[model samples]
Target: MELAIILMILLIVVAAAAIKLSDVGLTFPFSKKTNLYTPAERKFLQMLDMAVGDQYRIICRVRLSDIVSIRPNTSVKVSRSAMAQAATKQLDFVLCQKDTMSPVVAVDLVSVEAERSYKAQRDWYVSGALDAARIPHIRIKAKASYKPQEIRDCIHAKLAPLRFQQPQEPLVRGTLNNDKAPLRRPVAA
Candidate 1:
């Protein structure tokens, strides 16, 4: 009983010392971020929201693994390798269908300097993976300002191939057809 009490006291002293040391500057090396996005990313997010918010849901900073999955019937080794590669990468933004929440497009913001550096290699891998998954990937240059219309046009161009035409004519209401007189209700006799 005496040995157990002594050991407990020693452990308590050690823990107290560790806590005091942490107060001196040895605490966990992390703090909450003040802002979720940088100024440029915030600006672009606004533009993207304005451009397509009505049609699709925009999600930011999504992991690639969340957007894609390993194909079936693959060897275990290859599957593990593919998953490992995707796990560390992230998409800047993902445009998902409003109703189904299916990912329609992945967008990345690239600076000129990044394109000239090692980031280009990362982009190549991302592009290849997106292509293999049949998801459209768009890269927009990071800029101080973006026009919503321009952003809309760029997205539309990339999605044009996925659009299907309707076979039937749209109904036109509240108008005379073939120059006929408008229908009038009969007056009470």
Candidate 2:
């Protein structure tokens, strides 16, 4: 019992010493004020907001995976690693429907940095993914200030065609044979 008590006292002394030493220079968590959007980005986002108005909601810094998915068909399978890779990429902004939250268009901010090889590759991947999903995207160059009308024009030019595209009607086998004939299944012998 004596040995146990002494050991406990020694452990307490050691812990107290460590704590005293840590007071000299141990790092503690600190919170600093930081703006989420840079000045140029903020200006562009404001322009986008004015252009979209109440028709669509502008979402910023959306992950690529959040907006896209691999549509698995009966004959095709997707690997987990592929999905993880896509999740790492992100978009500058996305325009979504206010009521349904459905993504309407993706918008990318283009700057001089985008001319670099790595940035160009990233841009290609983003555009290709959006194309595969049949989502419209607009790449606008970064500017000090943007006119709301110009942004509106750009969105209209890109999305109008997609919205008005004609949907293909499913083929009816019986209709090709005879217009008046009713659809009927084959009789068993």
Candidate 3:
């Protein structure tokens, strides 16, 4: 009788521990979505995006100018402050150009899958773009993420401050350089 009671109590304790552990484990609070910037840095990106007037437009001419920025009120509520590292960009510096000051611009585009290969290039490109637009920005980078609509809204929100029209000659693909026999050498070398 004593052994049976002891075994039953042990089983009950084990089951209770497991139940409690599961309750904590299943919460998964840390599994919340990851972002590339902090709330503040996200706000900066949105502002910069707006100032640039959709130079990085994606397919369908769906300008990212409609995205809204994160409000200062909610910066504290965001969790990803650890990635708020500052970036140093060349365009942010001053260069003497014929006794005149001019902003520098550069571009290098890649699909989302190649992000790791050229992440530095991407950041510098964007920072240069913002500089070309004369949008003053903090030097810090942050981690943040949002839904597609939210991204769109953040862009739009930035664009709202400026007045501009769409470009007539939008970018389109051509096959001039895509042909198999793209070149021929001079007859008399």
lDDT of 2 by residue, 1-189 (tens): 999999999999999999999987776777875988878789999999999899899999999889888776623335465567678888889999998998989998877565672234446777888998888988888877789999999999999898669775656533545557676789998
Stretches of candidate 1 exceeding 4 Å from the true structure: 1-29, 113-122, 164-189
Better of 1 and 3 by TM-score: 1
- The lDDT leader among the candidates is 1
Residues 97-122, candidate 3: write the lDDT tens digits: 23232322222222243446433334
Against the unseen true structure, what C-alpha lDDT does each candidate score? 0.87, 0.83, 0.40
Best by TM-score: 1
Off by over 4 Å in 2: 1-32, 73-77, 117-122, 167-189
Screening candidate 1 with a backbone cut-off below 3 angstroms (N, C-alpha, C), the clashing residue pairs are: none
Order of candidates by TM-score, top first? 1, 2, 3
- Provide the lDDT at 43 for model 2: 91
* Candidate 2 colliding pairs: none
Q: Model 3 — TM-score against the truth?
A: 0.26
In model 2, the Cα lDDT at residue 134 comes to 86
Q: Which stretches of candidate 3 lie over 4 Å from their true place?
A: 30-43, 58-189
Q: What is the lDDT of residue 98 in candidate 3?
A: 30
